[model samples]
Target: MKTYRDYDDLPKIELPYGKEVSISDSTLRDGAQMPGIVMRSKHKVQIYEYLHMIGIEKLETFVYNERDRKAIKLMQDKGYEFPEITGWARANPADIDMVLNVDGIEETGILMSVSDPHIYDKMKLPTREAAQEKYLNALQYAVDHGLRTRAHIEDMTRADNYDFVFPLVEKILEIDPDCTIRICDTIGYGIPFMNVDEPYGIPTIVKYLKNELGAKNIETHCHDDFGLAVANSLAGYWHGANWSNVTYLGIGERAGNAEMEKLLVFLKRRIKGFEKYDLSCLVEFAKFMEKEIGIRIPRNKSVVGQNVFAHESGIHTAGVIKNPFTYEPYPPEIVGGQRNFLIGDSSGIEVLKFKVQETLKEMMDVHIEVDKNDKRLRNIQADIQRLFNEDERVSCISDEEIRAYVKKYFMFNPIVDQELHRREDDESPDNTI
Candidate 1:
């Protein structure tokens, strides 16, 4: 029998994605649009560095203000080839000029609201033709200025693909054959299923863009209003899209976009060419977002959460104590995380003994191996159960409390006491033990 570390041993999905498929981050642009979140120039620069460290190929940002320009300058000064900084703008010369003013930005996303609601209701355009003309003019301006363009077809899931989207995209490709078409599921109305009708079906849309319109590059930018952003993004890639737009922790307007960490982990594990990514920085990135940027990472978040590797229930801990693979899908160290056997009301003697041994080694530089039948370990479990039963305690016991209990039960040992005395004596001026 052979051991399989990842999903390569499982049946694979025959996706139509090319080897050039990659992820583009929107954490600094769309993610910053999340209400109550403010990422200054310095914070944006730090995030750019982290994204580069995680092997992100590209990242887009708003270059509409001095702060945005300063952040771009700082990131460019670092001289990292990956996470190439791009700019976001609306379908107008003024917005494109803002991006043009920022040096080192060779590409910019030109927003084109293709749906009738955005054309008439949002932009107050008289007709669909007017909207198309507006978008084309802006795209041409960007191209003439020597900037690569990405046409963001906003509200695309609800738009008329044949009458409006296909025509506009064809013209966009005519203006610049290299322009990337970014399909935006602005309200998260897109579905991931195949054989679904046009516009709403992500796979259908990507296939149409590649097969019908001859689009050389396509990106998927989905929202999580219905919590299907990642699924829809994958559906687009499975069909033909080359780029998947994402944000850190899915932070963005409304429910947010597809999560970057989640998508990366999935690709690294399931896809063939994605094994080159270094995933060790994922946990560190989550910590940086929480501690430095004041973003609260949900303890139960999929890839980098604090509690993802923690086990408390008796059944789970017992199985994990015998063989970690029995309970965990993958090793914690794969994402730079550690497994923890938390001591709680549901914990059993096995977990208690393990915790005691681990805490002793960490705090006292002593390794005291114990078993489930150890009396001191059983006593500790009994005290915890008593707290839950009598005192109605709900929270797990703290490490300090556990350390104190261990000291009470183990410090009295003759060997331990002698060792402690010897260490104290050696530290004295007399140098005696």
Candidate 2:
């Protein structure tokens, strides 16, 4: 059968042996950062457990700051089920100390500004070398404490100094070969579509880092400024990224982080052999998050979008009714969604008949076959179609109304037709044939 393995010839890299790519969720931290929303420690633990249940490999549970120390301590004491619980921090020992003090955070990530803009304009650093020292010092502190560190290269997309960025990554790698380094698009300013001249596209960056820094330890962290976070994250996975970072629903600063849903859909459905992920709990987690965070998922967003499984077009609805693959990328039920028929102007006669029949069958507990050519059904359908065309308020027509129309025009009540027959009697002709 066709599977992700069939695309072996394409530029693909394995996520790992058990799975091809690692699924990471940052909802607890980045997702909580959505404006005016707060998930208490109890809710935090709940989300953490849900993500772990869904088989997300890494959970960046919290940022190590004084303000969040109490919550982090609670989670640590609870002993969340995730194998890897990572702490986010600035590229400073003080920030790392906040997590190290939390009792049970084993893995750590520290981000440092890489672009010259931050160095020259923001921090007033004299030159790139001085900035490199500051970044390297912070990484060394995490290493000295025996923490498995993932150094985040910040503002990589806008950085004018790859010369500095590459050397900085090399410096951190030299200190600890086991240390993982991530290329971050800090201001949400990266693009996924490959361009020949500039090769910071996630895949290109992964390739460069792997060729120079080694693939065994390269990771990626993306933001969704231009709405390419999922694409960029996948590109990194395609090239060679063992670890990736994401937030649920891509909720973070500005546009947000990469959403775990989009990435997993591409991995589980589009890519084969990476099937070790237990996605049964995906929908539950997404719904829990939507309710907790108060953000309604967009209809056409993708993967978990409500309308992803909804069919509307006459041809598309007809084809999907026969076989979902005619229009769907995969069965909607696979992602915790059921196929839905969206009644619209583009609906065909078959759709109207099918909907009516299905409704009638359910209502009467018997099979119903609607004849599209039946005068009563045809006239009602025409009226319904015209009504929908004029007003968008109505989509579903009740079975009671349908039954009423059928009884009034198609069943034992033939008064309307009999009256018309009386009016036409003068023109009637005798027929013996």
Candidate 3:
């Protein structure tokens, strides 16, 4: 049963999405490649369980060497279900042998470079034919050795589909009709908009693979060099492709791949059948990864970011008090997150009224009714604006500071009075700014 929260009246896509969307997580392979990011074997296994909890469709592990093999074995030994593991390797006999040595990898991706850049610039092949020969030899070797294969066609958008890509795809399918094709948008050069003639258009690429060339289970692997990875992945599904290759935090080479959380949410919004997913675990996973590795998720980062559901502006916060749906697309619980109304210099009277009432009610252990038009609240907002904008120049006014102000003001009149000693602050980049 698909469950929806907050969106009692969801903006449903009445137009039929003809194909089922599949997700393939590549956090271990690609996300680990994020500069200065590292994941030990234990962390990888834990991440796998979390991914499984969120309904990850599949997962990939690179069988590059003995260390990679050992790590893969350790992860598999832990036995958490869902997200069937597949091996990733360049199209070659040696790579195939490495993957085959892994205890339980049932499939592997064949990195077949089909573009002029990959063929000549990267592979240094004299001709497309020569490149195809090398690729075919490896493809034959992988399929013949009892491993199901998928072609990760590197630099796909830059390649000529009619001239070379289609012909090579046809030959690969002729060798094994069940082989899947993973179109690699290497360097993030592809656009997500529809256009068959546009070489780098996602719709065209998926269409040529599925409709023109008769490929099976077409997948997309997009990079975020131009910030279109998620869009391109969605485009693949829109054009009848099945799998979206994603990383936990869009972690990959350079700008990274499509973010698993964002992509899954995108699909859940349009296509049904994700109600049972425990999306709350995603934030836990992201936070754990950030700490285990030394990377910090930016406050403004999408989905799992600390501030994605945080509201500061008075207009938004005031509206949020009325109906969160008026100010937000979905409830924070949709992804198992919390909504916070941050009191900053930009905060308004309405929000101040709400915040003051809530804070005093909790602190005083009483039902505190705050006046929206309270002169004290207006004075507080003005003081906050002055301090936030000019005097202290802080990004936000802390709750303690608000409490102190309220206590001080009440001391002058009748509410309450207390001056608490402030503690020395710890170092954090997010503290001041």
Best by lDDT: 1
What lDDT does model 2 reach? 0.72
| Candidate 3 or 1, higher lDDT | 1
Order candidates by TM-score, high to low. 1, 3, 2
- lDDT tens digits, residue span 203-277, model 2: 667777788666467767788877778777877776677777888778877788888877877777666566766
Per-candidate Cα lDDT values, in order, are 0.88, 0.72, 0.80
Instruction: Count steric clashes of candidate 1.
Output: 0
How far residue 420's Cα lies from its native spot in candidate 1, in Å, is: 23
Q: What is the Cα root-mean-square deviation between model 3 and the actual structure?
A: 8.9
Best by the TM-score measure: 1
Off by over 4 Å in 2: 1-19, 63-80, 193-199, 389-433
Off by over 4 Å in 1: 1-14, 413-433
Clash totals in order: 0, 3, 1
Query: In lDDT terms, how accurate is model 1?
Result: 0.88
On residues 1-433, what C-alpha lDDT tens digit does candidate 3 reach at each position? 6654457656565214455668899998888788887777777777888888898868888777666676777767768567788988887798889888887888988889888988888888899999899888998999889989888888888888778888898899888788889889988988988754646888888887788778888999999999999999988888888888999888889999988888877666655664545677777777887888766899888888998888889889888988897777667887878888879867788777877877788778887787777767777777777776666775677778778777755435442222221121234445441
Question: 2 or 3, which is superior by lDDT?
Answer: 3
Candidate 3's C-alpha lDDT?
A: 0.80
